[model samples]
Target: MFRSIVKQKIPFLDLKIQHQQIKNEIFQAFEKVYENTSFSGGAFVEEFEKDFAEFCRTDYAIGVNNGTSALHLAMIALGIGEGDEVIIPANTFIATAWGVSYTGAKPVFVDCTADTWQIDPSKVEEKITPATKAIIGVHLYGQPFDVEGVSSICKRHKLFLLEDAAQAQGAKYENIPVGGFGEMGCFSFYPGKNLGACGEAGGITTNNKDYYNELQRLRNHGCKERYYHDILGYNMRMGGLEAASLGVKIKYLQGWNQRRKEIAKKYHNGINNPAIKMQSQPDWADSVYHLFVIVTKNRENLMEYLNKQNIFPGLHYPVPCHLQKAYTHLGYKKGDCLNAEYLSNHCLSLPMYSELTDENVEYIIEVLNAYDDE
Candidate 1:
């Protein structure tokens, strides 16, 4: 048996180790930006944009202040405004809905699939109305939603398709990168994301030249030129320091993602507890395993047990967006998005990071298996 009293604490995530591995490269990136004095948005940001665009296999990429800004700008660029409606997964982080709400559009929430914990494409159409102008398919927890299923509906209904890839930097759907699959893909490079920057940062990817140009203007005060303003816009440009740091980090993203997958595999195969349920990976999804979420009716008990053993897990979201107080005005009741509400109450994320050792993974699995669900 493992030690009854453990001294090692397994955190839900540890960015410090990740930072340590790439410290020299990140510092060099910072030094270059500092020397250039392009503090706001300049060459460093531009270089990262180009590299990121290439990585996602998109023709163009636009860096923004943060992921929320990226989503808001993408919606605005799509002409979503007051009286318009957007379809999004109720299971997602509130930011996904915020993007639509910020654009003065109503966010219609859809339930998630029971197994994959993704937006259930089958349930999306029922929520669509004449006001529906777009659908934001979130690649929640780094697993791409059913792109083909959702895109088919979008095409049939003449609605814009946006990819919310905040947790899916290196993820793919059907062997193709995510961002390019939709009209526009929004990514967050927050300090905790798979390809996180040193600070808040985000990027948009698209193959549509027109949307790309409009997004560029929208993020930079609606100006193509320094002093000329083309349209009313917000000051949401990404910082040079964040961009430089992101550029350096992006180089290691694929490797880090691979390691995350390896750890997830260990958890998947080792956790034999019948009371615990894991998210299912469809054959079409090449997830980066941003968060290895598991569901259990006895979540609070399990959490307390893990805490005693110095193993701490986290909740992706303890509340579903449709049922949140902020969206109460939307008039959605508890059972409106059934699967999402169910998962919200039951799901807890395990410790998932590239920095975790094989022994760390085995220990986590063992602890989980030993948990008393009753």
Candidate 2:
């Protein structure tokens, strides 16, 4: 008689497990928001903004509806507009480019570092031009980029520096948090992020009071007082419910990030396949491992094999921004950003979350090792 083997199914991200862990806290926060009818920006949002600002070690934080809105407002507040060019790494999510586009600015693409998957600071200077106005350094996969190099370049060139810190919440470089390193640091609190809210939410951290006040106005229809407008702005204010939930989650971010680090360490030490290339972590970076990605020439085959075993994974980005159809008018071709293009094809995100179990990690490692043998 032949016996049937049942493979254990592992999800790429298990938000349900995380929710279960904080169910009561999330419920109570929602209850408070409902009771007070503070649906729009209110005390809940204000409290979270202050708490998050302290967490990022910044003097102020302004909450917005989403990360894209945060980036857009930051660009607008910094005076990035038509005829301006902003340099961004090509390997990041398309929203980074969208932010620049929303401000009527051109997004100049730069290739990421092959090992770190971050914006190559060495390649940045060559891209700077007379029209260049700002540089948005993205902390991809929760790892902080080379802040000192980028900061120095920004200082020398007299360009504004922004941190697209969507994936990096608790990450640090040189023992300092990433969000406070630049003029403005943007964050996303999507349900899956390191410091997630119940729904969509984002915020910006800054030490400059002027920028902080300007962002607050930009997010609230350009109104410092009721029925008064200084500049045309979007209604991009964050909701009270999302802020309340985020306030609860913020208290647990460090612990959750630590758990993610432990999981990443296990993957790094156990997955000994020569064909698989792991991301290099610099000594100065303390990454939170948002999505533990591995690069392999046989990515498609490996992904298929893992799926058959009921172990689902994900792709951070399968297509670089330059090659996306939406950006075709930018006149970029396939090889314009070679490193980012290569990473888009080779990268594969493993199942990584704070709730991922030890048994699952072992099973994944075993399956990967078996695939290497095959």
Candidate 3:
């Protein structure tokens, strides 16, 4: 018998509800931008950048068009280019690799730890060589990777460390926030992220003033003064309209992140299925639970069961970066990154938004715990 304890459908993500709560505030912010006519990179974007820098506990934050552009600009500012290699985890979204590829640098893949599903620092050193210029440590799934471990390796090898903090807006490692952990950190304010803008937006955070200046110029067509181009650059600047919306959303980020954590705790404590596995959190890292993922060998069956109960889940990624067709020229094989491949096959993301109701969570747990693929 199919259990229908919960009558309402639970979506994997409901950005609409989040927008409704702050609709008026968002409109007001937009009105201000409209009145000032700061449609492009102007006062509104500058204000949000300042606000974001303080929130991340960093000295500066440079706003950009999107997360991918933020990464690309950072790599350019760091002088990463053709023939250079940047180490990245294989289990990440392709945008992480895009940053390196855009700069004509090769992205060397590393396997994630089996338990934490984060870049395994143990595997990083083996991939580094004379051609390696930097290491982009992604705080995958809103959890901080082994910062000390990765930082130690960077120090020993004299490589630049960049934090891909797109999913970890409020996450921290040992009480220090993620964005300021490396030489530069990149963030995305995609509509579904914890602190999302109304439209596309992203930022780079750093303490280095020189990197800050370069990033600003790079994002705005390589010019500090109007119409005086210093170098070749793209039109990757963030709009004032998107930045204005982000300013309103940033205030409630902590509270929303806390609710996500509460839901994750319920899932952890309630699910008793023998076949299911979850990412293990480290003591030193505080995760914001951007995606509450569970791994099961019987993913297809579990997904079908959840769908029948009017619960729609999601997949963070079904393919690892190394296995993507775009990277085929790099000559990577299936068994190269075993951990990432296993996760790509087995991972399932459940409904994980701040707006997820308690009844929805309990019903999900009920359905999951009752499942028996045997």
Q: Please name the candidate that would achieve the greatest lDDT relative to the true structure.
A: 3
RMSD of each: 1.1, 2.1, 1.0
Error of 2 at 254 (Å): 0.6
Candidate 2, residue 47: the lDDT equals: 99
Ranking by lDDT: 3, 1, 2
lDDT for model 2, please.
0.92
Q: What is the TM-score of each candidate against the true structure?
A: 0.98, 0.97, 0.99
Give candidate 2 regions above 4 Å deviation. 1-6
Clashes of each: 0, 0, 0
Clashing pairs in 3: none
Candidate 3 lDDT by residue in tens digits, 173-196: 998889998999999998888888
Q: What TM-score does model 2 achieve against the real structure?
A: 0.97
Residues 320-361, model 2: lDDT tens digits = 988889988999998888999999999899999998988888
lDDT per residue (tens digit) for residues 233-316 in model 1? 799999999999998988888999999999988998999999899999889999998999999997888889889888999899
